[model samples]
Target: MNRRVSELGERGLIRRLREKFPSLHSIGDDCAVLPGIRCPVVTTDSFFEGTHFHRWWAPPQILGRRLLEAALSDIAAMGATAKWFFTALSVDPGIGVNWIEGFYQGLTEREDVILAGGETVRGERLGITLTVIGEGEDRDTILRRSSLHPGDNLWITGLLGRALDAPAKLEKAGGLSGKDLKPRSGFLSSAELEQLRAFLQPRAELELGIKLRKAGIRCAIDISDGLFSEASHLSLESSVDTVLEIDETLFFDSVKDNPLAASAAGEDYVLLFGAPVGLEFSSVGCSKIGRAETGNGEMTIFLDGERVSINAKGYDHLGVRK
Candidate 1:
């Protein structure tokens, strides 16, 4: 009889995988640590053509950029400077050569990032896996999700739901035809273009994370999954309860009238931190949403003084789709 992976859940699956191949250190942390030599941090991320993204949404170049950014976001969460990357690509033979070249061009365009090495293989669908290596400014100052403390205020950087809105915006512009997929800037209105850009080429909050580390803030996690899910992970890891008190006006201004959508939207790739006091970053907005308390990982959300029910769910590989 075959067992369903969904029955295990992500954490359980991870635990099982770790048990099968035990390592010297814990496996749940964001980056694998290699002792000595400036606390080097390493993280890997994978993107599948069908499950994670589609060609109809973004061109190959943009897709490659997004894949690399996703891996970099993990380095940012650890408050580290990304130094190099390795990519493994699984491509269908039918994919055009120009698309592959454009993907590499977009990925290598970053100023400080260097592509160390990678491999390519034939597959039925497109897949990209990126491994990012980074070094902390100071070994002692590396941040972790497990460092969150009781009474620490929770904060998030940048607007949410923009990535989630891109598909709808594309459909509204004219569905996912070939021309629509490879949309020109001149063809889209400013708002449509902005939304599409947000989805296709989201940036990692590396600088803000470095600043936060320098300012002595400790606990942080990047929002690759939804805000609610990532916040809940922090609470669980820190062994605390989190109460998310969202400011309706500010949230609406950022996300435009969909608080629930903002909470559940994934691929934002923004940094969310737990600090004792609010810290400011120029050109990036941060909002204090709630605080941590001593508890068994319970989380609550409040909107305008009324207790609102929020689904603390995000993208899960084995999770059932709605």
Candidate 2:
């Protein structure tokens, strides 16, 4: 009998796989470590055409850039400097060579990030897998989600729920359902353009993470799977409860009306971290939205002094039904 991966979920499946091929270093951490290196942090992320994104939503260049940023976000969460990247791209033969060139252009635009190596293959669908390698300034200073402690304040960098607004804006503009999925110049409103930019070209908060690490803040995770889901990971790993007091103003004005947007919006790629009270981050826009407490792993969200129910879960590859 074949076992369904959905029964195990993403994390559970990873755990089972780890047991089969145990790592000499850490297994559950965000990045895999190699002993000989200078505290190297490595992670891989995949972007699929139909599953993770749609071509109509963004141009090839933007899509390529977003994919790289998503992989780099993991390195940022570990408080490491991204050094090199390798990509494996599988795309349909129908795709234009110009489109592929555009993708490479976007991926290499970042001067600091070097594309050391990659592989290309023809496939039925478009898929991009990026492996990012980074190194911490000091091995002891690298942040880990499991290191969060009780009484530590949870801080989030940048606005949340901005990505959630993109599809809605595109739908309103008839771009989503239209025959031409490519965005036409001057067709989108200013607000819609802003939403598109946020969704398509989200940046990794690498500098912020490095700053936090240098300031002696240790525990952190990038918000790739929404604040609630990622916070739950920290809570479970640290064996603590996280109480998030949602500030309406913390969200973009476009999504502030939706109370659940900030908590449930995925792909924001912002850094969510825990730090000591009164630790100042100069010129960095961050807010103390919650705190970790000693208790069973639980995540509570509050808005306007009332607990609001949110039904939307984070993006889970095995859990989400097609």
- By lDDT, the best candidate is 2
Estimate TM-scores for all models.
0.78, 0.80
lDDT of 2 by residue, 1-322 (tens): 3343444443443354344323311244444433355878899988888888777665666777788988899999999999878777776656655466556666776878777655555568878889888899877789998988889889999888877666667656544322223355336656556656677778999988898898898999999998888999999998889888887876766677774765677888999999876775536898778899888788777776666545555322222222
Q: How close to the true structure is residue 209 of candidate 1, measured as C-alpha lDDT?
A: 87
Instruction: Please list the residue runs of candidate 2 whose C-alpha ends up more than 4 Å from where it truly belongs after superposition.
Output: 1-36, 174-189, 309-322
Worst 10 residues of 2 by lDDT: 313-322
Candidate 1, RMSD to the unseen true structure: 11.6
For 196-309, candidate 1 gives per-residue lDDT tens digits of 667677899888889889889889999888888899899999889999876544342435556666677778898889988545543458877789998988877776555666
lDDT of 2: 0.74
Q: Judge candidate 2 at residue 233 and give its lDDT.
A: 96
Which candidate has the highest TM-score of all? 2
Candidate 2 colliding pairs: none
Clashes of each: 0, 0
